[model samples]
Target: MKISEFVKQVNTTKDAVRHYEELDLLRPSWKNDVRYYSPKDVGDFHAIKEMQSVGFSLKDVQAIFNLKRTDGCGSEKLIQGFLDSLDKELEAVVKAEEELQQKKSKITNMILELKQL
Candidate 1:
């Protein structure tokens, strides 16, 4: 079906379909200013939505898609990339938590000082 029909059936916007196509995630057939999608497009959409639902970034989706193209199967390189990203994210989370705790301590000290005045 055409992109419009596909969007209606899949509950997605036309722009979103185009964006995914641009990202090389979907390869809908194109002819005469119109695009048509098949089951593959639907699968791509589902894959993207599923990943996004689970908090995967667009870069992550693109990386996974690229890996699939190269490896034709799950690759250890992709797995390692994901692990590295996860580790970096975890480190950022820990740093943010430490910053939050420091701010809490500072605020508590100010409150105590004000209370004694």
Candidate 2:
């Protein structure tokens, strides 16, 4: 499909799609000066959004994509690398959760003190 149709199908803006194209994250073929996106490109867009939702930066997503393209999808090395990244992200999320819990506890105690005043 064309860019407009692809944008509507993906529920994203033209600029966003263009940006992804510029980043080499979305590969659209050009014919007669018009860009055309395929179903695979649509899948790529969803994969990009899903990764971002999980707190992966565009650079991180790019690296993951690159690994998949370089090594076959079923390559053990790619699986190991992705697993390592997931482990690191999980650690960061756990640490952030602990910090948020500490802050919540402090806020609850302060609220109780204010109620006693």
Candidate 3:
């Protein structure tokens, strides 16, 4: 498919795909002036997006691709470290949200008491 169609199908912008291409994340099979993407390319594009959504930087994603290209596998230890860090961050976020909720409830009660006065 053409870049435009691929963008539409993937629900992404042309610039984003171009940026991915520039990062060597994904490339067209044929680069004879006009670019075309294959189904595999689309899958690779989705993988990049998914990784980004889950806190993987483009550089990290590129490293994964390089590893795969050269050795057919990414570093398990690196991926595990990311997962462990993400777990700790998620715990912190959840605790912060719970504290915020408690604070909100206290503020709401204060407002109600002032209204009653």
Candidate 4:
């Protein structure tokens, strides 16, 4: 399919698709100055969006993708790198959750004190 159909199928904007292409995340085939997207491209687009949904920045996603592509799927180094990234992200999320809980507790205490006044 072409860019139009691909965008419709993916339920995303053309500019988003173009941006992904610019980032080398999406590689549609070119023929006579026109780009043609395959089903695999659609799958890649969904994978990119899924990664973004889980707090992966485009740069992070690109690095992960590049690592897989460069090192191949079965490379132990790639698996270890991916695990390291996930561990870092998990730690950050846990820290953020703790901070949020603390803030919520502080706000609750302030509200209770205000009620006494």
Candidate 5:
């Protein structure tokens, strides 16, 4: 389907489709300068969103995608790299959440003290 249609079907935005194209992460079938995403592109979009949810920057996600798509890399190696990246991202998110919780706790304590005053 066309980029717009794909975006609609996938419940994603056009900018996301364009950004993925820019990253070479979504190479749609092009005809007469118009781009049409196939089922593979849809699957890749889901993967990208999943990665982003896990805290991978677009650049990082693109790099992982490139690594996975690179002709020279073995499929097993690419899969391993992606899995490793996911692991690191998960760790980073956990750390960030912990820090956020600490900050929130401090703010809550401050609010309670002010209320007492």
Candidate 6:
């Protein structure tokens, strides 16, 4: 499909899609300067969106995509790298959650002390 259809199908702005193309993150088959996206591109679009949602920077996404292209999706090293990134992210989230919970507990204790006065 054309860029318009591709953007609509992927539920993303044309500018964002263009930016992805410019970043070498997403590529559609091109002919005469026109881009045509295959149905399979839908999966690619979802994958990109998913990565972005999980706090993966465009550069990180690009690296993963490059690895997949060069070594195939089933490559153990690529899978390990992805898993490592996720693990790091998870650790950060867990730490943040712990800090927030501690803050909440402190606030609750303060409120209880004020009520006792």
Question: Each candidate's lDDT (Cα)?
Answer: 0.83, 0.91, 0.83, 0.91, 0.85, 0.88
Candidate closest to the true structure, highest TM-score: 2
Q: Write candidate 1's Cα lDDT for 63-112 as tens digits.
A: 88888778754688877776776676678779999999999999999999
- CA RMSD per model (angstroms): 3.4, 1.0, 3.3, 1.2, 2.6, 1.3
| Candidate 1 error regions (>4 Å) | 73-117
- Alpha carbon deviation, residue 15, candidate 2 (Å): 0.8
TM-score of each: 0.64, 0.95, 0.65, 0.93, 0.78, 0.91
Runs in model 5 lying further than 4 Å from the true structure: 71-74, 111-117
- The global Cα lDDT (0 to 1) of model 2 is 0.91
Query: Cα deviation in Å at residue 97, candidate 3?
Result: 7.4
What is the C-alpha lDDT profile of model 3 across 33-77, one tens digit per residue?
A: 889999988999898888778667788788777766665545676
The runs of at least 3 residues in candidate 2 whose Cα sits more than 4 Å from the true structure, single-residue gaps closed, are none
lDDT of 2 at 117: 100
Regions more than 4 Å wrong, model 3:
73-117
Higher-TM-score candidate of 1 and 3: 3
After superposing candidate 4 on the true structure, give the runs of residues whose Cα lies further than 4 Å from its correct spot.
Answer: none
On a 0 to 100 scale, what is the lDDT of residue 66 in model 6? 91
lDDT of 1 at 93: 74
